[model samples]
Target: MRSLMCLLFLVIFCSVQMTSSANLAIEVANSNCCGVFSNKKIPVNKVVSYYKTSSICARRAIVFKTIAGREFCINPETSWVRSHVDIVDKRTATPP
Candidate 1:
């Protein structure tokens, strides 16, 4: 009976370790990708900054951060997205 108890404990420990490792791997993988894109347009004035998604991401996208500290993932090819990128670029280029 003692041996059986030890075996069961080992199995549970191994399973818990495996589950934690899997969750960590998934988090690492998702950190580089934006899972969804926002279709709504955010006014340029509301944008605080922008950045491009990682090259490894399947979807080409730009992430815009708003003054209110919210992030919006947008398709990079969209006309308005391009315009926003240009405006943000110019804003960052000049001296304050």
Candidate 2:
């Protein structure tokens, strides 16, 4: 019984750690930029089209991952990113 309790505790702790790590990564990605930029732009719906923590320090940027597994920092102020964000927001918003 004691061993089983220890195992359960370990599992819970690991799960919490993983969740926090992912959250931290997202926060960092939203606030930072990547070290390099990709030559091609990825659509927002792509599989790799998600924000991630930038591996490098950049100013006013968020790391973007393309469907092709490429990573780069893009300026959120750009019309492209802004427009996509709007679209996503609209799609995800609760319907009246």
Candidate 3:
């Protein structure tokens, strides 16, 4: 019983740490120039505020790539591209 309790505590602690780390990464990501939907031009300052006000976290480092003269959110961990809603989209056109 004692070992089970210890294991439970360890799991909870690790989970919280992972969640907070992800949140921090999201905070950094939202501070960037790209918008969440991949189409809007949001102010950097506003983006910074967005992350601070929310508890949601991004699982990976967020990236902004300009492909074909358009902006996109590239989540490196999952290799997802916001513009195409696909895990990986080859740059169809030259980046601007």
Candidate 4:
């Protein structure tokens, strides 16, 4: 009985430690995951509809959305996308 209890306790303790460690890694990764998909992949044999000819962002999102559904490409690369909004300012582009 004592051995069983000890085993259970150890398992619970290890699980807790693993979860906390995993959560920390998730937080760190998320902080840096935004806007990481800018590098384009050649999307041939796929039909992507563009929202507008003028806006590149809309077009890129359409391409992703068409393939993966509405929310697949949340933050895309701005430079690869043609933006009508002056979307990327020089200030934001330049490092402080």
Q: Pick the candidate with the highest lDDT.
A: 1
Query: Whole-model lDDT for model 2 versus the true structure?
Result: 0.65
Clashing pairs in 2: none
Off by over 4 Å in 2: 1-33, 47-57, 65-71
User: TM-score for model 4?
Assistant: 0.33
Candidate 4: C-alpha RMSD after superposition = 12.3
Model 3 TM-score? Answer: 0.33
How far does residue 51 in candidate 1 sit from its true spot (Å)?
0.4
Tens-place lDDT digits, model 4, residues 9-84: 9999999999989977776554423233434432422323323222312243422323444323323344434442
Which prediction has the highest TM-score against the true structure?
1
Find the 10 residues in a row with the least total lDDT in model 3: 45-54
Where does candidate 4 have its weakest 10-residue lDDT segment? 49-58
RMSD to the true structure for each prediction, in A, is 6.1, 10.0, 11.9, 12.3
Q: Candidate 3 residues 1-96, lDDT tens each?
A: 999999999999999999989977877676544335444443332221111112243333344343334344534334222433232233233466
Worst 10 residues of 1 by lDDT: 24-33
- The TM-scores of all predictions, comma-separated, are 0.65, 0.40, 0.33, 0.33
Q: What's the CA error at residue 45 for candidate 3, in Å?
A: 22
Runs in model 1 with CA error above 4 Å? 1-30
